[model samples]
Target chain A: MEWLLEANTAGHKFALMAIAILLFAVVMGGILFAVDRPKRVPTWVVVAGFLGPTLLLLVVGLVYPALSTIRGSFYDKTGDEFIGLDNYARIFTDDGFQRVLLNTALWVVLVPLVTTALGLVYAYLVDRTRFESLAKALVFLPMAISMVGAGVIWRFVYEFRPDQPGVNQIGLLNQLLVLVGIEPQQFLLTAPANTLYLIVVMIWIQAGFAMTVLSAAIKAIPDDVVEAARLDGVGGFQMFRYVTVPSIRPALVVVLTTIAIVTLKVFDVVRTMTGGNFGTSVVANEFYTQAFRQFNFGLGAALAVLLFVLVVPIIAYNVRQLRLSEEIR
Target chain B: MTTTTPVMAPVPGEADTRGRVHSRAERAQKRLTSRTASVAAIVIAVLWTVPTFGLLLTSFRPELDIRRSGWWSMFTDPQFTVDNYNQVLYGGGTDFATLFVNSLVITLPSVVIPITLALLAAYAFAWIPFKGRSVLFVAVFALQIVPLQVTLIPLLSLYVDSGLAGSFWTVWLSHSMFALPLAIFLLHNFMREIPPSLVEAARMDGAGHVKIFFQVLLPLLTPAIAAFGVFQFLWVWNDLLVSLTFASSPDTVPLTVRLADMVGSRGSDWYLLAAGAFVAMVVPLIVFVALQRFFVRGLLAGSVKG
Candidate 1:
């Protein structure tokens, strides 16, 4: 930033960036308009028009930050040195980074699985119930909550006061446990378990999404097939196992893998709940810590890239599932 | 498709021998699969609901009682008063009612402006054929992945330069940018399902784009509009980040950030925080319940075959 400012004799902090962007948008819009004229536009013009905005956004928003991050990761904590993959190497060997990865992996696996299974069960049970709306609303309430709001609410749920330690725990969970003759447990700020606790919030918010999508898919299942399965003596658990599960398989895959990809980028809950302490750090949280807290943009960038690398395959798989569903239709 | 009469009960051994041990075990099993589920659902519902319930209770209770003990302990040390609500409404200070009005002012236009713009953009992406449409659409969709934190600094810089940083419009524009991709994606998916044949038929009648959009399409889009309205309303209503960035001034500040300050800065005053949060939540809750019917797959009645 210092070099760019020094070298460019424009002497205008905002003008250069703003004018460049506005001019680019205007030119691209004009090109798109002109090139789209029916058969008069040269093929080259059409190609340029089609690719311009995408190319501009990719370069400015994505590639620039990405390249900067890569360069920064090679540098020291202040992003001054050219340490050459020291951060990358550290990610594998460093205990902290490894813990972050393991916690993220646990999240990437557990939250999606639990949410989808719970959601599917709820959807199936409430399929044609009289109180279906009310039941669904109860579960869906969490979805309506902002992550910040939910975090704040849950903080009160897990609130601890050491000074008044035995003065009847105020946290709802501990209060209940105590009522049942169990000792109050510190749920947050506990190693490994805090990660799971964070995952629970994600699951709560995301399960409604899974349920909605899967319910739509379940409703789309052919009535004839369900009737046939019924006639074949499919009953109770067997019905869900053999008939309903297979029928909503696409929706399940979409929900699970979509969640997996999202969990890979989980940031807000961990940020709000534990501030990435107590071994609750994931790659995303680590990235934020490095970039914002520690000012190690390079390491943060590497962590972000690692996050993207992990997510890309899951995203591809999800997109492929969507395409397959489209093809089936 | 076989028309076999599949038994609703378990096929012999699988009949939830656990839940079925009781009378009407089949119905009980149908009620809840595992004892864990029943217990879990009840526990979660109660636990999850308590904080909000506390907020509600505190809204109605006196400030003194709220600060005295835990809200649940209200059962033991019962002290009831409507002083919180009184202060919220008619207190000599900045009451929540004034903040609620400010919230409405902040929320409504923020919701309306972006949704309207996104709808037009979504239509063009979904249906209009100027050229470069799919590529343009994909570019917009990809914007969904760009985290707002990265953009905020640049956007704030831009806002400062443009003399819009402290204005309400700044927050609106921020929400628009944050919301545009997802809104476009959702609306595009919906508009695509409106059967091109119907659109083509309208086109054959020599209807221009505006006419076609208004006469033939807008009515059909009511449910989508309603759903999107609810979504946008909820988002803008609940938004703190944007309000914090653009509208931190006393006159311009929306309720969420105000509520945050009230909770965090005002000596952890549960009475004030709860009352303030309740003020913020009521509108969104109303919007959620009222237009919730549009949330169903009903509008796709003739659009798709299952």
Candidate 2:
């Protein structure tokens, strides 16, 4: 058992993986075997066999912890003293935290809108073109890599070498500046601007998602509608504006709200690229910093609650849009 | 390309109408093939790829060369080596190979456990005659909005009390827990799409719910399973926050956590960082390319139809 927990050797890792899978198989197989036999088994027994593990795990893991964290938001840093609303108040009033809120707002507003716009245009341009699949794949490749990996790649792109003789700039952006005889700047060190740079990495990732979804929606448009629009002499920008845009309105809404929800909870890009320094910390990263690093569990819980609150309206709008789209379908 | 070109000539009857149609087709083709549109498409693709290509180029350069010059310089002064990858994977201080194994270990159980559990639960919700099924399913679906951040601290303390704090078990359990809501929702959606008459025919044959699920529904649900499987695989393998929170021991940290630590501890080591980043990315890239059809199907099903 101890080796199962602490082992690092290849043999031990594989052994533990096997043990874990075998344990799950035994437990699940036992439950199924018990339920498989015994003709005319009661409804209660069947329900228990099916929903028992899932309900228990969800209750223990998600429901209980979420409720406890919300409760903890009212307490002090140590979580021992009950200080009502102080943590939430500090989030609203503190200067540094104000910047966090502002940055979070910027990220939520900018990333989704920009990514969706780019995705729509790119999807429209590349639709039915030669090499459409390959072109889309190039954009979508970023989505496959982890955010931390994307962060590393972009961090190198944003790397700032000193401006001096014989010190050729290594980062692509800075190198371009040097080639054009302009001074190379610190891309990740400048406040606010650094936030935009980090947001660019996210846009790079999510634009693929937006494009894929919108392209499907674009293809789903009825052929007769397009043919009629063409007969009516609508083409070029007008066709995209009138025919394609309205046809994919539901998908557009879904992409926008989904990306907004994701952006609100983004942590890795900020953590990896800048470690949330230089006024670049959003609510999610700040929550981790407060809760885990700073050990301010109360404040962390507050930030988490804040993120939840912010996500609610976006989700509500998404659900409404989905319902509308389903009705149309 | 042939499809887009207006190859037909104007007909004798209704010559003006035919000309109008031909001109529309020609204009559409021109719009598509216009230099500006082609240039814009190529520019976007190049911009999106160049950053990653630069890092990939640096990954093969010698450490000294990477630090002293731009990756683009290699085109003129072409030099390359695999030493950076060698050091990043097996060097003295950074044991990323072990972390790579840990990532695999953490990801497999995480993907498998939730998927298995969610399948059973989805079947119950979709097929089994049970009370409160709709309410329970809705509650589970709604739980997707509860960001994992809200649950991290209490869950961490729970793991601490159980003495599973730094084990792979904690990471597996957390990921499984976090994934269940979405998995159940997605799987349940897929399960409902299965025709009721098939389930009824199985029921008519005196088959039990368990038998019908295995024989009838599971086979039909393969595509959905593949879709969600790819999703959960990527989610768990690429996760950093949950792994960082639970798997703190050097033995248990996954590749993303180790890579993040390297960035924090040694921010300037471009050669090693570049190679390490690629090492983290390679599995997912391969999986994405190979399973791309199912991956996109899963994405569209999960998000577009949610």
Q: Please write out the lDDT profile of model 2 over residues B135-242, one tens digit for every residue.
A: 998999999999999999999999999988998889988999999999999898899899999999988998988898899999999989998999999989999999
Report, for every candidate in turn, its global Cα lDDT versus the true structure. 0.64, 0.89
> Could you give candidate 1's per-residue lDDT for residues B160-243 as a string of tens digits?
787766655566556655666666677777788798998899878776454566677778887777767777777787766567
Positional deviation of residue B30's Cα in model 2 after best superposition, in angstroms: 4.4
DockQ of 1: 0.11
- Candidate 1, residues A1-329, lDDT tens digits: the string is 33322211223412433443455447644654565454465544544554444345445444454455555567777656788888899898998888988998899989999989988887776665444555666676666655555655665666554435436565667777777977677788778777777887788777766776676677778878986775565556788899999888777887788678767777656765677888998887787677656766667667866776676677677777767878997
The residue-level lDDT of candidate 2 at B86 comes to 92
lDDT of 1: 0.64
Provide the clash count, candidate 2.
0
Question: Clash pairs of candidate 1?
Answer: A72-A298, A73-A298, A230-B6, A231-B4, A231-B5, A231-B6
DockQ of each: 0.11, 0.55
Error of 2 at A199 (Å): 0.6
Docking class of 2: medium
